[model samples]
Target chain A: MIITNIETVPGRTIVEHYGIVQGSTVRAKHVGVDCVAGCQNTFGGELKGYSQLLEESRNEAMDRMIKQAQQLGANAIVNVRFGTSMITQGASEILAYGTAVRLE
Target chain B: MADFLFFVVFVTAVFFIGQHIQKKHFASLEAREQALLYLPAVVGRKVFNDDDVERAWLVHGTVVVSGDYFKMMLAGLIKFFGGRISAYESLLDRSRREALLRMKEAAASEGAHMVVNVRFETSKIDGGNPSQQTTGMFEMLTYGTAIRLKAQ
Candidate 1:
């Protein structure tokens, strides 16, 4: 499917509007990679382990969101948004959401 | 002298073992999952507005150390092989799942079906500190258009 951060795909026209679609997942430090994170404590040029964990979580949520849209019969989705939060002392949650729509 | 030598050997062995496990596990899991998409022309012809779309989705997920025994085994195999590529694959699979689910929900709300020309992105959060172990994690984001296919 045509996925983009932009509200609309360049040449396509939206026909119908689906309310809102979302997918989310929660993760904990014990289940994640062993690495140090946060902007304040990063070593020189090395990539932090937490950063990698967040990336993985984000992708999983996006995939689920797309699958749901397809099942709803939407040809495309618009106005997509992403969010992150600390669910517990050592865990985090990632969410993906957008409006499903039919195109001309 | 013998004590010092043993310590060096022990440390080296631990490092190698950790690297090995990481390689083995990542490779197995990454290979098992693949991203698939279905885009039909009827849905493709619609003229969609970028701004009308409104929001940009940020999809994310994690396998975690505590869940899925099978996945943990796979990760261990990946670690055995060496390199950090396995980590990327793990995150990629998760991001794809999230993006698709969100798209489906959007389509349902609009009373439409199907999404076309799906796109994906991957990035490292770079929390910065290598010494800090509790706050590190990777992030992935996938975005795409949700549309209704024309009726036959």
Candidate 2:
């Protein structure tokens, strides 16, 4: 499925808009990465563990959003947007939202 | 006396290591920013120029950075004084810029000439509240659509 944050996809036309479809997921890190991330804090560098976690969370959210688009009979999602919020002490929520559309 | 000695050692370590890391990060950002001078990325919600009419794809760059204990402690002390938490400023700056650079790199790899509608999302991963530990993590996600211009 084609997903672009732009209002319209390049080289394609939008025939119908299926309102807004969205997906969100909440995730918390494991203890091993938590300790490693803690140790990483001492040196003040990139926390690869947490970065990967966020990336995974983003992709999962996107996947669920795509499924919603599919259910709406849309082939693509346009004007996609991503959001992230700290849900709790150790957990975060990542959201993917967009306008599903049938392409011409 | 023992606790005092440990604080002294910890403060010294934070000073050396934290400052060193911060300096290195800025230096890298300086170089990378210069290298990415050609990519036409902007934060505007709408694309200003539409003449190219080429391919566009979604791209994202993510970065996570941790704060040193010294900065955390310094922020704590500043909180008591009701002043700005300047110690953590560099941490935010570093993560945000790094995330943007990564997004640029992703776009560049796709042979994209520019990125548009760029937006940044940030969140705290391992701090805040009484249940969590002392790990101070900030995550920045930069995402946009990379635009590849058609060859003339």
Candidate 3:
């Protein structure tokens, strides 16, 4: 399915709306990565592992949202937005949401 | 005594190296900003200056950056007093500009004349340490539709 954050897709016309759909995932760093990240906090630089963790979290959330849209028979999703929260000291929650619609 | 000395050395080394790297990154960003000045204007709204669109497609760019030790230290102090945190401001500024530049470059590479309906998203990834007040990484993401206006 076509996915975009813009209100309208460039070439597609919306035929039906499936309302709002959302997916979210919570992730926490493992002990080893947490140790590495602790070093990064002191040393001050890009934490590649944490970055990757967030990326994975976001992608999983997005995929789940897409799956929901597919189940709803949506051909496209628009106005997609992402939200994040620090669920706990060691955990982060990533949420992806959008309007599912049928495109012509 | 030996362990204390090693700790001092490690902090000093990281501080100096991080400074060097930041300086280099700032210089490079400045140069690239100048270079990207002529790229298409990217805005958040959907109104296109030229309506004769022959072709258009979505484009996106992302950048990940983190603060140095000095910056984090400054941020920590600012958090206590609670004023404008210029250290984090520069970090955000750099990330935003870098992401936009990457988007512009992507449009240019695709031979598009302009980009519209631009949107930006930011995410912070902090190390899972409760005691650490500073974020470990920040990501700036920008996306828009590149348009090719028909020749007049």
Candidate 4:
């Protein structure tokens, strides 16, 4: 399904609305990754491992949302948004939500 | 005594190194922004007419940045005093600008002329360590719809 974080997908008109669809996942850093991140904190720079981990989680959440949208027969998702929360010491919950719509 | 001595030395070293790195990063961000000024990234939901648009797609950029020890320590002190933590402000500012720059770069690489409905998501990724206050790591993600207009 096509996805855009806007009210309407460019070059397309929405014909049907599937309401709101959402997907979420919780991810924890591996011990090795945590060790690497600790080093990053001490030395001060981009935390590559954490960035990768969050990016993967976000993609997974988006995929799940897309699957739901597809089940609703929607061809596109609009006004998508992302939310994040720290669930525990090392785990975070990533949520992706959007309005699924059919475009013509 | 030795522990305190090492802590002092580490903070001093990080202070200088962090300043240098931040200066370099700011310089680079300025140059890259100048290079990408042709592309307009706006937060409006409006899109160009279909006749004038060739294609549109989603694009995003994510960055995870951590503050140096010196800044973290400074933030901690400011926190205790309940005042504005300027040290951390720069950290957030840099990451946000960097994230937006990356999104713009992505759009440019796709030959897009404009980006719309830009959104930002900021999260602290401190490994959830209870002492995360001092870790001062944040992840900034910027996403938008990139529109490539038809050539006139």
Candidate 5:
């Protein structure tokens, strides 16, 4: 499905709107990854493990949102947005939401 | 006495090493930005259509950056004085630029000419209690729709 973070997808017209669809997931890294990240923190560099974990979780959230839009018979999603929050110490919740619409 | 000595040595090492790494990162970010200057990324929300557009799709980049203990402690001291914590400024700037550059690179890799409606999401990830530890880090995510024009 076509997705854009604007009101309308480029080169496409929205013929119908299906309101808002959202998906969210909370995730954390394994102990080993966390330990590695902790060691890397001392030198102040990129935390690859955390980055990968968060990106994967974000993709999963977007996938769920896209599935919801697909179920709504929408060919595209627009005005998409992402949200993140720490649920606990290590776990974080990633959210993807957007308006589902049919394009012509 | 040994504990205090170790603390001083560790802080000194982090200060010099962290500053060096940050300078290197900035230099690399500048070089990459110049190389990718041809690809325009904009945050305009208004929709505009180009008749020559061939395809459009969403692209994103994510980065997690950490701060050294020296900066973290400096920020703490500044907090007591109720002034700006400038030490963390570079950390934030570095991550934002890195994330945006990565997004532009992704669009370029897809052979897209431009990225529009760019949005950034930033969040702190301490991984544990903030007061108990001196660690500081954040994640930055930038995304937009990459547009490829029809070849003439």
Candidate 6:
């Protein structure tokens, strides 16, 4: 699908605002990874572990948001945005939202 | 001398255990990417209620990173590996996913089956100070069109 962050897609026109649609997910660190992360901190580098976890969560959340929009039968989403909340010291949540609309 | 020898062995064992745990942790994270297939499909659809026939929407993404512990660590790792600073992958991935969903929703709403002329852009939202925080915050954005698939 055509995706962009710009307010307007060059060739397409936004028809109507379908209100706000969103999807989100929360994640916590497991003991296995936390223990290792604690030690890995000593050497201090990219925790490929945590990074991948975040990536997975983000994708899931986005997918859900898209489904919600589809259910609404919007031809496009405009002015889309993402927000992240640190739920706790070891956990965080990612949210995706956008304005659903029809395009010509 | 015997006591010293036993202490050394114990310490060695603990060290190995820690290493093993760390290795396992890394392995688990790597395994996560495998389930990526089950991730939701990105889709968006829109219908123009107005008379304008040239419907279009803009999709763009920006990667914002604030200064923090995680940001520094990531930067250090990139430097250590002689790799370019790509601390924005997380943001990019997030944006891309969101943008796709938005597009899908828009398309589905308009009874469109596909989107076209997809494009992407990246930018910085905030340039936080490294001295002020332990980690950095950044953003990535993605946007695109939701179009009807041409009739077969």
| Candidate 2: TM-score, chain B only | 0.90
Write candidate 2's Cα lDDT for A1-104 as tens digits. Answer: 88889898877778999999999999988899888887777767788998998989999999999999999999999999988887887888899999999988
Off by over 4 Å in 6: B1-152
A2 Cα displacement, candidate 4 (Å): 1.9
Query: Over the stretch B56-140, how does candidate 5's per-residue lDDT look in tens digits?
Result: 8889999988887778788778898897788878888888999999999989998998998899988986654456563856899
Question: Best candidate, DockQ-wise?
Answer: 5
Calculate DockQ per candidate and list them: 0.10, 0.66, 0.32, 0.60, 0.68, 0.11
- The TM-score obtained by model 6 is 0.45
Ordered list by TM-score, greatest first:
5, 2, 4, 3, 6, 1
Candidate with better TM-score, 1 vs 4: 4
Query: Candidate 3: misplaced stretches above 4 Å?
Result: B1-12, B31-41, B49-65, B78-82, B101-114, B127-139, B145-152
Tell me what fraction of the real C-alpha contacts between chains A and B each candidate also makes.
0.07, 0.72, 0.27, 0.62, 0.64, 0.11
Candidate 5 lDDT = 0.86
DockQ of 6: 0.11
For model 5 the interface RMSD, in Å, equals: 1.6
- TM-score of each candidate structure, all chains considered together: 0.41, 0.92, 0.75, 0.91, 0.94, 0.45
Tens digits of per-residue lDDT, candidate 6, B88-141, equal 443344434544544444455555434544544343322334454334333343
Q: lDDT of candidate 2?
A: 0.85
lDDT of 4 by residue, A1-104 (tens): 77888777666789999999999999988899878877767656678888888889988999999999999999999888888888776678989999999999
* Candidate 5: segments with Cα more than 4 A from true spot: B45-48, B127-132
Give, for candidate 1 chain B, the lowest lDDT window spanning 10 residues: B59-68
Per-residue lDDT value at A41 in model 6: 39
Please provide, for model 2 over B5-73, each residue's C-alpha lDDT reduced to its tens digit, 9 standing for 90 to 100. 997998888778988988988999999999999997897645544556577789999998877777777
In angstroms, the error of model 5 at A70 is 1.4
Q: Evaluated with lDDT, which candidate comes out highest?
A: 5
Better of 2 and 3 by DockQ: 2
Off by more than 4 A, model 4: B127-134
